[model samples]
Target: MYRIFIKPTLILAAIAFAASFALSHVNKITRGKIEERARQQKEDALKAVLPPYLGYTIVEKNRKATVEGIEFFYSIAQKNEGEKILKAYVFECENPGYSGIVRSIVAVDEKLTLLGMSVIQQAETPGLGARSKEMASNKTFFEVFFGLSRKAASDKEAVSQSWFEAQFTGLDAGKKIGIIKKGEWSAENAALRQELIDHNAVSAITGATITTKAVILSIEKGIAALKHVLEQENNAPGEAASP
Candidate 1:
């Protein structure tokens, strides 16, 4: 009787082991496809912000190894048939939203202008900060940075940096982009501030100032990160355009 029961138990154990091995193999086989699908989804979001007539390529094919401390993927979008690098970028960033982290990517043209940006991932209050992602209306929030450049052309101010990073739009690369201190800013900066106010200048979500600032600083840091990268690129040898 004992022998008869033991044999049946052993057979059941062998079958269970076989099933586990098969599932493991299937997981390995499909992993590549799964990863590819995720990558395509991200690519679609980034491309939406870029101009339709422009062309671009991935400077770094993989996002994980490109930048440190930032958990999202990034790529440089270049526009030109060839040889001309129109834009240099690092994509995807995380900021605190009304409810949670809001993630996005910042793009700068070869001339160091903020070309466009997109929110790739975010979890904010359903109607407030979440609105930051709306393509139709929320777009103005991002467009505020277009053609924006640093205020001080000299390394002194460029390197000084700001906790609440200045938002200066329509700025050429070699200009002093200023900001308003509630009332002290010049007409130009005040206009910029008003535009941001009209479009939501990193406004705190109704009652969620912490969450709102998180998103604001995230964009700020995103700009800072790109600035740092561009500065390095400008100093790199063999990258100078021939006259």
Candidate 2:
């Protein structure tokens, strides 16, 4: 009875313990690398959303605050002349999308004009909602087939900005940014794109109005939090308002 039941049970328990220990050791070894990669990804997203102008230094404050009972994180970008010139405030926000959460980084200037926005994380539908992060390729199929594409030599440079996210740039963050179903935006249609920009609106992704509205809601909530924090900081005793 000892060899048939008790001994086998003890051996299986030992094996399970050994496997758990090995997994724990492996996790300890790779934990730092995982965290570092996440940090780097976040830093890259911050840089992507800021204005394209040169000489601005990004400082990741990672400050935490709450507005309307929701927590938010923000950072600042500055230009160093003789002194620090406040360039833009970058805020990270997320909202529930059609399939999952869609997170984005948004940059706005002192006057609340949106500098840019980048969708960093999402698990939305593939063809429709996930297109929010899709980059527009500068070269067409025919251009590539003829080998006449300017970026043919470097495929990595062939893609331009994410059309969905790029539409938020230069819009007013202080006011309600609108959304219209004009069509998927394209650089080729410069005139129609300008019309949407003039209306302070972004063209909604085809068949993904829920995902589009989720991003807009996230931006609106983030801007409101930023305004609240800025107001608090400006009113603090002996502290000048942030430029």
Candidate 3:
């Protein structure tokens, strides 16, 4: 009895250790590539939202703050028309959602007009809350926000680029943004939807009210946190240095 039970337990322990070691080794090997891909994806998302600019500078790295356990990041876009004027300000934040944390980024012009928004990470229910992702054309929410470009010239084309995310553009951080679900949305009636758009209201995904609010809250919190930074930088423009 001892031989039979003890032998199997030892074998299982050895197998578990071997598997753990192998997984750890593989993770170490691929860590660099994974980080590179993530960095590239974020760079792409930042560029997708900001207006045409010569370049960008990261003013602050991503870090969690004590206030409400929120993590935030910030950047500044640059234009080359003449002196390198600060084109726009970009920021990111993570907030809790139905399934897990939802990460997002928002851009705004120097005058405080929203440029665009993109969902960086989420773990919500698939086909519902997960629809918040900002994927390439033909694979994201409504295809209005698809395609990876700085700007779309035509109104129709611009509307399609991350339609939901794009709606956040032209909005101001000072306003109290609201949510509108599809059950009440009149997609067929352009006028009704336009009204919602005009009022800083986000059109919610059917059956995903919680996730929609998560996005809204994340944006709001990001704006609040970023405002502190923006105010400080503006008040002390010479002290701040770009990353």
Candidate 4:
């Protein structure tokens, strides 16, 4: 009886130990490649956000950046001019969607002007918001935020907050960025609205308005957070001595 029980127990132990060894080996082999790929991917995303005319370099990682008074993690990318900056990409913000988090990489120039933004990940419903990735050239609803220009630093909220949040379009950094009923919008707003509508406005995936809102809010909050950091630095008076 003892011999019979001992044989089965030893077999089970052997199997468990083998499984653990295999898992550890896999992790050790893949860890470095996984980290390298992630870093390269982030660099590619940052390049997408910056204006075509400028160059960029990574400034920091895993730090907070804000938009529209909201905060999120950022990987700052900057363009150099001998020793100065010509453009910058502040943060790549991610927000929860209906199925998973949607990620966006936002870029601003040295003058603190918005350059462009691109979706990194989204699991929105198919045929609706899932089409955001295709909106830029296909006239879909989601492309409105792309190529959004900023005339000044303060204008970041103007473009990201109002129109994009409510799914409005043609908004610049100087616009009010608000929402109204279909007919209540002003002539200018009405014109912008129709343009978006014509663009197909990347229609919400029927039951996924919450996910859409999350994407917009993430961008807004990210911009707001970075703005706060820049403000703090500007007020510090002596922190500029070093990079």
Top candidate on lDDT is: 2
Model 1 TM? 0.48
Q: Per-residue CA lDDT of candidate 3, range 26-123, in tens?
A: 99999999999999878767766764443555554553444446445676665554665666677787789999999887887676667877887889
**What's the residue-level lDDT of 170 in candidate 4?**
25
Off by over 4 Å in 2: 1-37, 52-54, 80-86, 145-160, 240-243
Candidate 4 error regions (>4 Å): 1-9, 55-87, 110-113, 121-194, 197-208, 239-243
- At residue 146, candidate 3 shows an lDDT of 66
What is the C-alpha lDDT profile of model 4 across 56-133, one tens digit per residue?
Answer: 666676676444555566666666678866546466677887778888776655444456566667887785567554
lDDT of 1: 0.51
Q: Which residue pairs collide, candidate 2?
A: none
lDDT-based ranking: 2, 3, 4, 1
Query: TM-score for every candidate vs. truth?
Result: 0.48, 0.79, 0.70, 0.54
Off by over 4 Å in 3: 1-5, 21-33, 51-71, 80-87, 134-161, 183-193, 234-243
Q: Residue 72 of candidate 1: its Cα lDDT?
A: 41
Candidate lDDT scores, in order, read: 0.51, 0.83, 0.69, 0.56
For model 3 the local lDDT of residue 77 reads 62
Model 1: CA > 4 A from native: 1-40, 63-73, 81-84, 135-212, 233-243
Error of 3 at 27 (Å): 3.9
For all candidates, the clash counts are 1, 0, 7, 18
RMSD of each: 13.5, 3.9, 7.1, 11.0
